[model samples]
Target chain A: MSWESFFQNLSNGISLGGLYALIAIGYSMVYGILRLINFAHGDIFMLGAYIAFYGMLIFSLPWWLSLIVSIILTAFIGILIDKGAYKPLRNAPRISALITAIGVSFFLENLGLVVFGGRPKGFYRPHIFDEIITIKGVRILSLTFYSLVITAIFLVLLFYIVYRTKTGLGMRAVSTDMETARLMGIDVDKIISITFAIGSGLAAVGGVLWAMKYPQINPLMGIFPGLKAFIAAVLGGIGSVGGALLGGFILGIAEIMLVAFMPQLSGYRDAFAFLILILILLVKPTGLLGVEVKEKA
Target chain B: MPFFKADHLVMRFGGLVAVNDFNLELQPGDLVGLIGPNGAGKTTVFNMITGVYRPTSGRIYFQDKDITGKRPDIITALGIARTFQNIRLFTDLSLIENVMVSYHVRLKSNIFEAVFKLPRYMRQENAMYEEAMELLHKVELDHLAEEKAGSLPYGEQRRLEIARALATHPKLLLLDEPAAGMNPNETLQLMDFIKQIRDEFDLTILLIEHDMKVVMGICERIWVLDYGKTIAVGTPSEIQNNPEVIKAYLGEEEYA
Candidate 1:
């Protein structure tokens, strides 16, 4: 492949990886606390994109405001999912919660299908996001830079929240031991809701970035990205935020590079991603950044 | 009024009655011990008192408040904290961070304030950090405060649990089997450690310990349970000489 083409793919990969990382952090945070895979998280991504779309078109809101509204709305939906579907099953078996998560996933998918229609629509963007910039003979979309910067900001913000603050202390405590955390005067339910809210908010923002780059919207858009980002979470170590970021960039770069390097194998990209997930799970079941988080009960 | 009281607390799981008619009363700054043979539901009593389990019947009062069946965290905020029998430290977190989590109950900042690192949030967080480090220092684990809780030696992990418990500024501290697997020498040091903290923190402590020396050596008063029923309650020497206590520990055949 020519160097220019490689750089183009590289830029695409970074921007794509940013979305995956943001989404994967959500997966990691929720999974970190709940120990449930949250099969519907991807659906939240879809819901986020839909929320953004409606905010921009039906309500005629500015892009930033729409983005904010989408994030808040999607976050509430996430909390609602936890309240409606998962809270009742908190004392039930792990498998029961997992099954319910899958149920929620399908429910959101079909809900989107019914409400947003099955046909794909063109994703709208303001001119600022679409403008192009060139650096050293390498042409890159402004969205590429935006995604990278935004993702970095969120990453730093996430780290700060988890490591540096009181709410974060409670969150980490709950993630470690919910019962003990409760004994320490932490409202576990509130913390869990907060976790869902944060996870879904990031997923919503990630969804917007995703749609901006893809320039296409469908009811099912979250499926591939969600599944791949889940794979990234696993690759990084499902519970560790840093692990999710590392796994995301790796998966995105690998996906883009694989397609760019081998045209014939592009069709096998999904299969290849799964293969990577399977291999990583087999080798390090803990993920790259994951320490064995199991409590010594 | 007594600082803490458990009135006829009982716990049943399915057909098995884990604890039955357990009762206790403690004055402020008193050190007490709960003793029992294995499967005697000692931990169940702790669980009920700390709000980990709801009593099948009866009430728990802390400082005249009906704390029975309240959420554990609420009880913690009401000035009660505890350590687990098997060491339930936030093992993934560093020793200092583990202590810091207990301060979460005392933090006045909301999620947004915390997320933004607002000035109010920063002041409280800074105070919490200083206090957490001071707690670690009290336990003499300050040097290893940066180490993960699970990485600590077994005895130190117990110490960390105490430091974490103290961070809540509890009036009553419950320690379940704090020296379960320690060597006699470590157990001796732990007894001193326990007494030091009780005095230092001005805490009323109730500890469950298999180590007789630690329990009998330090506790001013004692309660004994066997087969989920209270066998005796008195001073340590009184407990040591009580015939019922002997029968409970040695079983009926020898006493008979």
Candidate 2:
């Protein structure tokens, strides 16, 4: 392959990876605390995109305003889901929670289909993002640059909150051991709610950015990204924030490059991630950055 | 009134009684020991008092407040904190993180400030880190503050647990087997550390200890349990001479 195509693919991969990383962080954060794979997280992302789309088209809001509104709305929805679905069952057996999560996932997906319709809506990109910029002989879209910038800013803010703040300490405490955390006098439920809200907010931002880049919006759009992001979470180390970003970038680049370099293997791109996941689980069940601990009794 | 009281406490697991009509009272700044042979319900008393398990027929009072059947966290919020029989450190977390987690209850900042990282949040976070470090230093584990909790040596891990519990600023601290599996030297060190902390924190402590040496060394008052019932309650000298306590420890075979 020519270097120009490679660079083009590389730029595209980075942008794609940024979105995946954004979504993956949410998954990792929730999983880190709850130790439950929030199957509905992807639907939350889908809901976010829908919220942003409606905000822009119906409310005639600015892009950034729409993005913020979407994030807040999505976070609220996540809070609602937790209160309505997960809270009642918090003390129940693990399998019951897992099943409830699956049920919630399906419920959200169908709800989206009913409200947004099956037909894919054309995502209306703001004019500012329509321009293409050539950087070092590689043409990159404005949205791609925007995606990278936003991802970096979000990551930095996330890291700062987690590492340098009191709430972050509570969150880490809950993620480490809920019972012991409570004994320490941390409000376990409040910290958990905040964790869900943050995860949902991040997913929402990814959803909006994704819609902007693809110029397509649909109820089902979140499923592929959500699944890929979940895979990215596992690949990077299910509970590690930095690991998710690395995993997302690696997955995105690998998928895109494989399609670009091997035309015949294009159809197998989706399967490749699952296969890699199984191999990783087999070789290192904790993923890339996860530190294994004795399962809590 | 005693600072804490458990009256006629009975705990059963299915058909088996783990603790029967167990009774104890602790005054402020008192260090008490609850001792027993294996499966003698010593830990059960600790568990019951700390709200890990509700007694089948009894009530617990803290500072004259009836706190029976309260959730463990609620009990903790009510100024009771405890460590596990098996060390329950957040193994992957840094030593300071484990201690800071306990201080989460005392933090005034809400989720908004935490997620947004507001100035108030930063101030609170700084204070918590400092407090955690101070507790670690008190336990002489300050140098291990950044190390993962599980990475600490067994003795240090036990010390860290106490530090974490102390971070809650608990009025009553329940330590379950703080010196289990410790070498003699570690046990001696732990005994001294326990006394220092109890005095330093002005804490009322109730501990479940299998190590009679450590238990008899520091506890001002001791309770002996056998077959889920309290057999004796007195000063260490009284417990040492109590006929029931000797029978429980040496068994009827030895007594005969």
Candidate 3:
């Protein structure tokens, strides 16, 4: 491949990796604290895109306002899902919560189909995102630049919240031992709700950016990205946020590079994620950054 | 009125009655010990008071508040803190982080302020970090504040658990087996440490200990349980000399 094409592919890969990291952080965080897989996460991503789409086209809101509204609404829905579906099962077996997560995923998908309809709609990106910047010989989309910058900001903010703040300390404590966290006067349920809100909000951001890149929106649009990001989260380490970020970048760059170099392998691109998942599980079950945390009894 | 009280607390696990109609009262600055043979449901009584397991029947009160079956965090916020039998520290977290977590319930700033790095959040966070360091200093673990709680040796882990609990500014502290794995020398130090904390913090402490030496050395009063029933309650020397307590400890055949 020519140097320019290689640079283009690298930019594309990194941008895609940013989206995966955004989505994967949600998965890793919820898993870290609650030990729940949150299968509905992908559907929440889809809902975000649709909300932004409708906000712009139907409500005629400004792009920024619509994006903000979508994020807030998606975050609210995320908290509602936890309060309704997962909170009741807090003391239930872990398997029960996992199964309920799968059930919640289906419920959201069908809910989307009923509400948003089955047809695919075009996602209208703001004009700024459509501009192409020629950097030396390489052509980079402004959307890719925005995605990378926005993703970096979110990651930094998340790290600060998790490591620097008292709430973050509570989150780490809760993840370590819920009963002990409670004994420390940390409100375990509130921490959990906050976690869901943050995770879902980030997922919404990922979904909106994802729609801009692909320029398509459907009820099922989140399925591929969702699954792929989950694979990235696992490949990095399911319960570690840094691991998820690493996993996302690796998966994204690898996918783009593999497809770019070997056109014939494009058909198996989705399969590649599952293969990575299995290999990571077999090789280092904790993912790259995951410490082996004992499940609370 | 008692500073802390458990009225008719009962705990049952299916067919087994773990603790039966247990009752206790502590005045301010009381240092009491609960002791029993293995499976005597001593920990179960602790569980009920700390809101770990809601009593099958009974109420727990602290500072004249009817705290029966309240959520554990609420109970903790009401100035009760506890350490565990197995040393439940946030093992993966640094010692400072573990103690800092205790300040969470008392934090005035909410998540929005924390996430946005608002001034109130920064002020409170700095205060919390300093207070946590002070707590570590009290436990003599301040030098190792950056180390993971799990990496600390067994005796230090116990002290860290107490430091973490103390960071909540609790008026009442429950310690379950605080000296379980300690040697005699360490146990003596722990007795002094426990008494010092009780006096320094103005705390009413209820302890469960297998170390009779530590209990005899420091506790003002002792409650002995066998098969979930309180067999004796008195000064430490009285507990040692009680016939029923002796039988409970030595077994019926040995007592005979």
- lDDT string for model 2 (A130-169, tens) is 8898877888888888888988898888887788776787
**Rank ordering of all candidates by lDDT, starting from the highest:** 3, 1, 2
What is each candidate's fraction of native interface contacts (fnat)? Answer: 0.85, 0.74, 0.94
Q: lDDT of each model, Cα atoms only?
A: 0.89, 0.86, 0.89
Off by over 4 Å in 2: B111-119, B250-256
Q: Grade the docking of candidate 2.
A: medium
Residue pairs in steric clash, candidate 2?
A184-B102, A185-B105
Better of 1 and 3 by TM-score: 3
> Worst lDDT window (10 residues) for model 1 chain A?
A288-297
The digit string of per-residue lDDT tens for model 3 on A180-254 reads 888788889999998999899999999999999999898988888989999999988898889999999999999
- What local lDDT does model 3 show for residue A282? 94
> Any residue pairs clashing in model 3, and if so which?
none
lDDT of 3 at A205: 91
**For every candidate, C-alpha RMSD to the true structure in Å:** 2.1, 2.3, 1.7
Best-to-worst ranking by TM-score: 3, 1, 2
* lDDT (tens digit, per residue) of candidate 2 on B28-106: 9999999888999987787777776788999999998999988777788889989888888888789888888765667
Which residue segments of model 3 deviate by more than 4 Å? B250-256
Q: Give the residue spans of candidate 1 off by over 4 A.
A: A295-297, B250-256
TM-score of chain B of each: 0.95, 0.95, 0.96
